[model samples]
Target chain A: MSASRHRLGRLIGNAVLLAAVATTLAPLLWMLVTSLRPKQDVFDGALPSALTFDNFSAVLHSVDIGRQLLNSVIFAGGVTLGQLAIGIPAAYAFSQSRGRWSRWAFAVLLLTMSVPFVVVYLPNYILLSEVGLLDSHAGMILPQVASAYGIFLLRQHFQAFPRAIVEAARIDGASEWMVLWRVVVPASRSAISALAIFVFISTWNEYVWPQLVAGAPGMQTLSVGVAAFASEEAGTQWGSIMAAATIACLPTVAAFLALRRQIFNVLLEGAVKG
Target chain B: MAPALLLFGAFVLWPIARTGWLSLHDWNLVSPDREFVGLDNYSELLGDPDFHRLLGRTLMYVAIGLVGGFLLPVGLAMLTLRHAGRATGVYQTLLFVPTVITTAVGALVWQFMYLPSGGPVNELLDTVGISPVNWLKDPSTALPAVGVVGAWQNLGFSYMIALAGLSAVSPTLLEAAELDGASGWQLLRHVVLPLLMPTLLFLATTAVLHALPNVFVAIEILTSGGPAGSSSNLLYDVYSNGLRFFRVGEASAEAVVLMALIGGAAVWQMRLIERGVTYER
Candidate 1:
């Protein structure tokens, strides 16, 4: 009887976890379902009476979603590239060096990380406009690339780099840059790729900054484009709006699924700091 | 280092200093009209009834978010901790799915779901023999409705954090407790919950810090803090003040208040992590 009770408890436990999973994914699943239903029948019910992919075509064909998707790719890629170029080196300096200036730089990164973006939003806008970058992709991507948290996270990863290998490379007459390129970067591929995916997903999904900086739909990223699609559709055009949203969401979801372990690692690492 | 610092100054530090400077002056973003107000903006803000309401509402959001972030994750962690084996990884990946999707997109999807006219959420209510409620319309339910979206999106990340914390507990210790005749309640209270404290505190503090800025996207898409500004939080209100209404000085002052508030929370959270990590070690 006691053994049966334990089995019963285990049964109940799995059931509850499954329920949690179902609840968590229910809205996202609904978003996917809405995206595929015929436009006219989108309001019919939760389950599609009939399914069609016309909504996808409508979003891609009628709207500037295609351009925006490309723009998102470019935007995310550009920021990722920009950040890795700047942040990796900074992480190297911070992790390997015992210099006062390197310590000061890390402190600066941490300080800037603490200052939430809203406090500086207006001033950044004014500065961007002063620099003649308003309504441009540069305005949207540039501010994000200088991520203080990125430096901090990479520093964590860099500190875990085996110091002996670096010491060997340096003793063999390798320059600092040469050591970084040949030893550190190659060794830290997993962490760097994970960081790249993190940056890409974040910069791709950034709505508020892009909405503020990229004025017109023509210049907007996929996130802003779909948001605009939703407002224009309201409740009337759920199909196309869902399609746009699904398009905006696809890359990140796909990335998460593909690189589950790595992305999950970053999530836990960057959990509280974000 | 030079390049990152230069951009950091241009984007983060200089702008923060400018926000401070802007808070003291009565000037729009670009208008030639300007005046030095000398703490007038802040004094006026302190006396403002709407600001008070906004603060109260903001705290309400934080509380609701904490309930979702804290209880839901703890519940999930407790359920799956023992049952965790082969099936555990799959369930975890499923739950962590939401944290990856663009929140802007997530917010819009919620907008469609919370539709007043024949939305899926109301239809589900109908199936339960309850009448449809305007999830995003009624002032009484509006904030909670938006807050639910915040909760749903947050549950996954919080669950992950709790899981991370739960994993930190040694299996030997739990098995030892079980061998000591601990089951269910005693096992949890005596062995599990105490070990989870640091992580829970970290989650709670971060939840409070995340309340404002993160919810801005959801609120913007879902309600625009509308139906009488019932759902508006501090971040959204400040954004509207500065961006939409051109009340630069008042908005900057509001921004400063929020900055100090979040800055305090972030510092507290960092300290918590620092202490918690060492304590765990």
Candidate 2:
């Protein structure tokens, strides 16, 4: 009886977890289904009798989705590059220092994470406008280049680097920059890749900041483009909207699937460290 | 160090300082001169019923989000903790899928799901012989409905945090509990929950702060602060005032109030972190 009860409990547990996972992922699956359904059959009771690739073609061909996708890639790429360029050295300095200034600076960095962007949104807009960068890629990229989370995560990774390796590199006549490049960066690839994936995904999916800064249609990212597409209300083109959304979501989903293990490890590691 | 500091000053600190200055004056986008308000904006905000309603609504959003967001994830983490193996990876990946979707996109998806007709949520209800409910349209269900979506997106991250916490518990203690004839729920309540409090507090605090900014997205996509402004949160109110109506001063005042509320929560979170370290023994 006890064995049977244990088996029953295990079955129930697996069922519940599977249900939760399905509930969580159902919308995304529905998005793919809706995207493929013919436009006329989008809201029909049952699935479309025959799936069509026309919606994908329409989104890719009819709209400026190709340009928007390119714009998203460039914008996300530029910000990721910019963040690594600035964030690494700052993280290195914070990791290496044992002084009051570095300690205080790290604290300030933590404080920035908690500071809401809304507080400074207006000022940022005004500043970007003052510099004549409104409706430009530079306007969107400049503000996001310095992420507090990036600095914090990198500092955590850097602090975990072995001091003996740095000393060995220094004794071999390696400069600080050389040590960082050869020893630290190579050792921390997993963390850096995790952070890069995060930054890329976030920048790709970010809506409000891009919406606020990149106002013109030509400069819009995928998220903003989808929002604009939906808000236009040029009749209820449910299939087309789903197609565009699916296309917009494909990169992140593909990235997650490709790097599922690493992404999971990074998130779990972050949670553990926190 | 110098270059980093210079960039931070130029990018982060200077913008924050400018926001402070802008808050004290009435400046429009087209105006060349700044009109000195001298706390009139804040005082006027105090008299605005809409601001009060938004604050109350924001608190409700936070409360509902905290329960659904943190509790559901914690429960999932606890359930999955004993089964940590290859299958766990699949569960975690599927769960984290929602967090990666754009908030705008997720909102649109949920908006369809909550549709009264032909929506899966209502279809399930109909199978149970219950009447279909208008989720986003009704004032009563609007905020909670949005909160559910927010919770769904956030569940994976919080679950991961709780699982991390659960993993830190000493296996010997769990064995001891089992030997003491502890049932499954008792093992969890007595052995697991206490050890997990620090991580729980951390997750809860972060969850609350994250929920605040999200209210704006919820307002935008789900209800548009609709069904008689029941869902007009502080963030949406600020956006509507400053961006839509160009009431720079009023919006600045609202922003300042929100910062205070969120800043207070941040301070509380820091204190919790410090206390967690001390209490871990």
DockQ of each: 0.64, 0.56
Candidate 2, Cα interface RMSD? 2.5
What digit string (tens of lDDT, one per residue) describes model 2 on residues B125-181? 888998999998888888888878877777777776666666666655654554455
Task: Name the candidate that leads on TM-score.
Answer: 1
Question: For model 2, which pairs clash?
Answer: none
lDDT per residue as tens, model 2, A101-167: 7899888777777877766677677788899998998888988886677788788789878899899
**What TM-scores result for chain A when each predicted structure is judged separately against the true chain A?**
0.91, 0.93
What's the TM-score of each model vs. the native?
A: 0.94, 0.92
Stretches off by above 4 angstroms in model 2 are A269-271, B83-85, B129-132, B171-191, B275-281
Task: Assess candidate 1 and give its TM-score to the true structure.
Answer: 0.94
Candidate 1: the clashing residue pairs are: none
